[model samples]
Target chain A: MATTPDLTKHRKMHRGSRAGIARRGHTVAFGQFGLQALERCWMTTRQIEAARQTITRTMKRRGKLWIRIFPQKSYTKKPLEVRMGKGKAGIEDWVAVIRPANMLFEVDGVPEVVAKAGMRLAAAKLPIRTRFVVRGRA
Target chain B: MKSVALEAFPRAAAKRNAVKKLRAGGRVPGVLYGREGSPRAVEVDQKALETLVHHATSETVLVDLSLQGASHLALLQEVQHHPISGSFLHVDLHAVRADEKVTVSVPVEAVGEPVGVKTGGGVLEHVMFKLKVRALPKDLPEIIHVDVTGLEVDKSIHIGEIQPAAGVEILGNPGFAVFSVAIPKAEEAKPTEAVAVEGAAPVEGGEAGAAGAKAEAGKAEGAADAKKADGKKAPEAKAKGK
Candidate 1:
């Protein structure tokens, strides 16, 4: 076998001066490979119910768990699933619903502002058994 | 400015194996630094990081991060994902004001089933996940909706379809293609000429007729199964990532 020179000294892209921010942990999770199993429980009762309804509708469409809400709203109000009769124009600001057990999850016009409140909502209101999934991209 | 009390710490020693092991336990290593704040290293839960990424638009989220019982307000600055397989590796959080106007990407969503889909056998496709926009700290969007119900197969839905909220402004080209309705891709199709060539063998000869027919039938069945499966798995992968 021909003796190959040690390539260890050959500079690779990962290490250099002013190096790209070091991977704090493993670069393992970056843009997750294959599929990422992420289950986010609704933190509040309203959030839980809303997420459940959303998922129900989403299941009818594409099954890819793709939902993005701008100006994400706070899940503080009661999620009204009841019809107000003949285009009553039931107004809504922010909402998300997911029923994983039944294979469903949905979100409508969620804003980013509620991202903070969502943490609280997730901690305070999500249903005991509710779950939602999304593709992981590191 | 409504400032959040976010905690700051120095980065942990950079070592591949150490990070993989730590993150496996849900502890993500993160860095924090920006105007008026010094840099530090910190560790946050893996689950918490994923939740924030999903719910928040970008590294633009305000984290009232607490470290060693001390808290400081910060913005989700940068999130690094693995190139081939998208996975969260390290997140960069920039401590900022609770009410500051920051620029970030907000997902642009299509609302209502497309007319192209209703009249045509088309499925809704989302081309953009987040649109870059500028807004106050409180005006970020988890996602934006664009209605495609009126569209036809020849027509398309673009970033122009997105309607910005008050105090929020979209930053991408208004004409960028968000999604469209078109014919679905056909797979595993054999040429007509090829079929004719094979068919001629059976009619032109008689002894191998039974075997040829069975082979052709099996190939058709396999193609049907493949189509059914293609639609099923793409969404599954998205679900797992989310």
Candidate 2:
């Protein structure tokens, strides 16, 4: 199933800044270990799904995965031969604006090695650089 | 709980720029207060503070702070760190007397392998990672260990069932769940099927589906227009990109 938001007030939105570090959702809140983003990027639903699938497959569904960021922002794209003066195009895709230090994924109920391996595999499917973080310390 | 000896010097500079200068000079500026007279600003070496934090087993650490000529037993209440670098920025130490009781959150550790996880292919979930407890400085524990050897599938251990250390009073809700063994996610019943079976009646007519689809389309268009009328609300993106 598509991982877009069920209901959005806005069909399309202007591209916002992705410069600063994440103020919140930066810690490994819900799990023993987490995959923290080291760079800012627009994380599409497909990338998130691909990373989630990779992690779940690597872990063999032994642990629980928490997706911290939701793709609430809608990005629109114009079709072929579209005029510049026309209104905003239909929503092409949904994306989550991720910043540095934002925790993208968290997994628990698995060993540290297994969780680390799963996060490493999942990070390969993402655009931003990521670091593996434990619960207590950064 | 082990009382680690840490040395602190009186911080003469209390201004914001001075604190920044102190941090630049490899010192973590901190405040010491509690059942004492006034809050004293002190600074500890950044390396020593980091070492103490790294080696500590739990968040709650008891330290014997030697300042000037007197020895003060203090609880490491809060330590702020730089978000990205994870470097220690500042610290707060609450001095405690031997007779006074202090409340702190202690980390909970699962001790043994659960039978449900071993035999029934269940996942062990650590529900409550930390427990709040009130105790004297000497009786305070660094971490609380709960044995889960006999825990079965779909069973949980509550806070009331676990035993506390001597002179330590567990402070939170007694019925709060600490740990549980749940069946694997794949085996869990699907929510859609459950809702269909229990809540909604079967829709046999195509008319109803067609009408619902039309209503949904109308709602979407109205929502889009309404959203456009008001300025587009972006997600909590603090930074402005060019």
Candidate 3:
């Protein structure tokens, strides 16, 4: 129920392997502290929602939370025992394509210690390894 | 040095959720303060603010802020953005006077291709992208241009070598290198005579024995030279690779 905005109307997408990230988006959005992905992986919408819920629950909604990524790409799967090459499988779930060095979440208006603890808890729900990062002084 | 006129209104409340309401209403929360006056909370039109910031040539922006029926000179200090949407979240402006000097970071740009890189098959490396400078608000430049056209292989341009505009002074160590022309890795990584000598040395060791060892040791100097050359070449490749 945490995941909303039904996107099932879209057609099935090709399952392309992970590609390396070429650039980090605009530097302005980087917050004081955040979680960075260390490897390429598909983050499901349910997983993102679960991680978000865990952070907000831990923080008690006292601070600002920014989900740096969105689950826009859809992953498809075939039914069990189905014959191959008939057609593409139906859409299974939505996912966000995460690459190494991409920031997953950012927290601000909160103390650094609390943000780190909350991000660590959120990281536990992710499929890929993550590292905590702080914005460097420019 | 160019001044931009901006209008802002005072924000009555300073709560965390107030920012959300302000954004929903198409306004951005900001603060204005510095040595010139007390800190004041203000808000500006989001579209106008985005245009001002987008067109700004440097991090330092001179704004003629019209607030409370008075105009004041200020500089754009810091801007915060929403991590996901990358939208403007907050802005901090520092009040300033035309006569006072302020220290700020200005972008450093290379104007031309280095002779070494163009002809000598070397790579141009930009060691530092921005330089800290001190100057009056009127004398601040949008960017500092360093001409690397004359730079040759193994030569570098240091901070001390740059001649800044009148009234502008660069900060930090003067000897720090801003840009350098380095030999490319492809040319440096090519196998040399020393490598061939080393490859052939071990094969002939059984017959020549001690003489081979002496010859190998003699060739060790050439290997060391090759290694030294490699050490110098690796960094340029790494820099370009990134």
RMSDs, each prediction? 22.8, 9.9, 21.6
Interface RMSD of each: 13.8, 7.0, 22.9
Measured by lDDT, the strongest candidate is: 2
Q: Write the per-residue lDDT of candidate 1 for residues B78-188, one digit (tens) a residue.
A: 776653234567878776565677777665656777777777655455556667888777666656767777878656777776678888888878898777666433211
C-alpha lDDT of residue B172 in model 1? 77
**Fnat, 2 decimals, each candidate:** 0.07, 0.48, 0.00
Each prediction's TM-score versus the true structure? 0.46, 0.82, 0.53
Q: Please, what is the whole-model Cα lDDT of each candidate in the order they appear?
A: 0.50, 0.85, 0.76
Residue-level lDDT of model 3, residues B1-242, one tens digit each, is 79899999999868988778988899999999999568999999899898888888765688999998999998888887654345788889899889899998887888887898677866566678789989999998889999999999899999999999999999989999988877633223323433454544231322234335657897998899899979988998899899
Model 2 lDDT per residue over A20-41, tens place? 8999999888889999999999
In candidate 2, residue B165 scores what lDDT? 84
- For candidate 3, the clash count comes to 0
Best by DockQ: 2
Descending-DockQ candidate ranking: 2, 1, 3
On DockQ, the stronger of 1 and 3 is: 1
